[model samples]
Target: MPERKPPRAAPLVLDVNSGYDELNLGRLALISGQKTVPPGLRRWQKTILTPDGRPVVITCTVPDDQVVPHGLDNDFMVGLVNLCFEAGLPDGPFTVSAYGLLKASGFPDSAQYYRALEESIVRLNKANYTIDEGWFMHGPHSWTTQSFAQVNYLSYVRSRSGVRGTSVITVQLAPPIMESLRAGYIKPLDLNFYRSLSQPLVRAVYRQLDALHFDESTADGLVRELSAPLMAWGSRLGILSDRPDNVARTLKPAHDELRARGYVAEVELTGRGRDKLLRYVFGPPPVGEYPELALLLSARGVKSGVAVRLSTVFPERIEEAARRFDHYLKISSRPVANPGGLLVAMVQRPEDFAELPGYAAADARPGPPPAETPAKGTGKGRSARQRPAAQDELDALEAREEAKLAALQGQALVDWVLKQLTLLGTMKHFTLPERSQLAELVLHGQLDGRTVVREATRAIAGGAPAVLAVVEDVRRHLQVTHP
Candidate 1:
C-alpha cells in the first residue's frame, strides 16, 4: 500500500481581521456579486471590478453557457461554512450527507428538493472566483492563483431513485481556506433564518445586515442600528454602482422583505443629495407571532437613527407610534413631514399618538369650523356668539393643523418623485447626472415635485434613455410655462 499523505499544512490562516484582507473587503462573506444566471446564452461576463475607498481588484469568470449558480445556491455554501467549523475546519476531502445538506438548507425532503440540492452542488463546482492582493497569496494545490471553486469537489447520485436518503458527498477545502476557517475567519449568523428566505437578494442582504453591528448595541449584545454611506454600503455588498439611489432601488426589496417578515425592525433613508446615508434598525429575531405594524414602523421615519435611539430607550413606545402612525398615513390625507421625529415626540408625550389604522372616523383630525351666512344680512351679529369658547380654541387648532396638512401633502409628493425616479433609474432610464439635477431641484425647491414626476412617468414609456431628455424638457417647460 502507498504511504498516505498528511493533510496539507496552511502557512496562512484566516481570522476575523484577515476577513478584512484587502481582497475580502473586511466582510465576513462576499454577499453581493452576480448570484443568478441571465436568461439567455450570454456568459456572466463581468471581467473586472475596482471598488471605492481604496480600490480592490476582483476578477470573475463563469464558463460560457453554464448558469452562474443562482443566489439561492449560496445558502448551501453558507451551510458548508458552518459545517467547516463543526468538522474542526480541516483541510481535505471531507464528507457530508445528502440528508444533512437538505435539512440544513431548509429545503423540503421531497425528491424534487433533493434534485435542487444536487443542482446547486453541480453549479458550485462550475463557478470560479479570484481575489487579487498580496496578503491573499496562493496555496500549494493551485496552479498560480487558486480559484475559490478549486477548493471544492462534490459527487452524489443525481437520479431520483439512486438514493433514498443520507447520500454522502466528498468536499475538499483549499489548504489556505481551511487554515482561515480554523483561525475563525467567520462571523456569527442566523443560519436558520437565512435559509428561510426565498429570494437570493434578500438572503444576501440578510447576511450583510446580520454581519454588521450598529450604533445602539442592546443589553443582550444584538445590533439594532446601522449607519453607512449608501455608496459605500452598496460597494461593501458588491453592488455594481457608484450611485446610492441606484443601489437603493436594488436593495429596497431586500429591506422590505426583511421588514415584512419581521427580521428587521425599522429602516430609514435620509441625508443630502447623492452622498446620502442609509440606516437600518433591527429588531429581536422573530421568535413568536410577529406584530402586524412591523411594516408600517419600518417604512415610517426620517433621521431614523434618532428614532431608533428612542425605541432602544423605550421599546414599547415604538409599537405605540407604529400602531397609531399607520392609521394616520392611511386616513389623514397628509403625510407626516418627519415621521422619525414624531415617533420620538410621541414616546415622550404618548398623548399625541393617533388611533389605529382602521378607525378613521375616530382618529381623523378636526378641520375648521363651519361658516355662518352673515346671520341673514346682519354682519355684526356673530353666528358664533352662541358657540362655546372651546369651539374657538378648536377652530384655531384646526387651522394650524390645516397648514401642516399641506406640508404633509408636499412631503408625500416629494417622496413619490424620489421613489419613481429611483425605480426608473434602476431600469436604466434615470442617469446619475439627471438624478443629481432632480435632487438639487428637490433641495432648492426649484421645481414642483408633482410636475416632474408626471413628466417622468410619461417619458418612461419610450425607455430609460429617454428619461433625461424628458426631465430636462419638463424643467424647461416649467420655467417658461409654469414659472
Candidate 2:
C-alpha cells in the first residue's frame, strides 16, 4: 500500500451553544476558577438578573462521588462541544476518540493531560443543575425554568499505549441542551485565539466575555463595554475569594493578560474597597490591526503569515474570493476538509466560479444596495405627485429583500437536512445519480429528512446497510399506498 496521509486538521471555530454560555454566565456550571475545590462545598446558589431586570436563581449540586469541575474542565467542554458539531450534532449518543478530543481542544497527548481529561469527564457526568427561572430556550426565543444534568451518560476506555491510543468516548448530551443547539442557538468562538491565551482563568474569562459581547440579532452593534461591581463580577466568575482586595489581586494577572492581548482596550477599577466596580472595554485583537481579508482568512485556520501575505499582495481579489469561499462554507452540507487549499484555488481562477450559484455578483456583494437618493422638493424623499411612483419603488425594494431572505432560509434548511444525512453515513452510500435524485426529493419535500436520518443512523448502528434498507423500505411503502 502507498503511504497514508495524516488526518486533516478540523476548523478551529466552535459554535458555542448559547445554553452552555448561559450556564456559565449564571454560574450553574463550570465551577470556580481555582485549581482546587473548596472543601465540603457540594452545593451553591447564584442569582443573576435577567435583561428585563427580573432576578433568577440557579442551584448547582455536586455529587459526593465527583469534585466540582473547574479550570481545565472549561477547555475540555469546548473540545467536547466542537466534537459534537463535527459529528453533525447527533440526536443521540455519539462516540469520539480520546486522541481526537485532546488535539481538537489544543491539549497535548500526554499522561498528565489524559488523567486531567478523565477527571473532568467524571465530574461533568455527576453534576446536576436547576434553574428556577431565566433559562433561555433558543428554540422559541423565550426564557423558562429548567433542571438538567450536562451529560446523561458517559463511558470511556483507557489506552495503555501512548502513541496508538485509540480509546473511544461515548456521551449523550442532555435533551434540553441539544434541542437548543439544533434550534440555532449558537455563536462562533475563535478556538485558535482561545487556545493562545496563557492562563486558564484568562481563557474562561474570555469565553464568558465573548458570550456577552456577541449579539446574534444585531451583528454590527456588538456590546462594546461592560461594567460590574468588583465583588459581584468575582462571584459570577466563581472566584474562590470573597474579599475585595484578594479578588482583585487574583484577577489582576488575567486582566493584564487580556489587555496585552488586545481583547480588552482597558480595564478600570473605580471607587474603593467594597464600592469598587470593574469596567472593561471590549477590543477584539483583530479589530484594527488586521485587514478584513487577513482576519477572515486567519479565522478559518489559515496561518497568520500566509493570510497577511495574500491579503496585502492582492487586497481586492483576495477579499472577493474569501467572501465567495465563506458563502460556500456556510451553505455546503459537508465541512471543507482543506479550506485553505480550496480558497487558494478559487483565488487563482476566479472565473471558474463565475457560473457558480453562490458567486453571483449581486449575492457576493455584502449588504443591500443603498437606497435611492431622495426625490427633489420632498422632505421625506418623495413629492405628493411622485407618491405612486416612489411607492412602487419602495415595494419593489422590499420584495427583493424578502426574496433574498427567503432564499437564504431555504438554503439553510436544505443544508441542515444534508448535514443530517451525511452524519448518518447515508450520503456516502449513494452513487452520483442516486445522490442527485435524493437531493431533488429532499428539496421538493418528498422526503421526511429528519425521520430518514434518524432511522438510517439506527439501522447502520445495528450492522445493516442503512442506505439500501431505506431505499427498499421506500419502495415497499410506495407500492403499498399506490397499489
Candidate 2: regions farther than 4 A off: 1-29, 139-141, 159-164, 216-219, 284-422, 425-483
Candidate 1 lDDT tens digits, 109-212: 68877777776777677767565441232345322334476336665433356432344444665555554443323333545566667677787777666544
TM-score of 1: 0.44
Q: lDDT of candidate 1 vs native?
A: 0.51
Give residue 371's error in model 2 in angstroms.
40
Candidate 2 residue lDDT tens string, 274-343 = 8899999988522322367767776765655445444543345666677788888888899899787677
Candidate 1 deviant stretches above 4 angstroms: 1-35, 40-54, 134-147, 160-166, 214-247, 260-265, 271-277, 282-483
Extract clashing residue pairs from model 1.
14-180, 20-26, 429-464
Tell me the lDDT of model 1 at 25.
21
TM-score of each: 0.44, 0.57
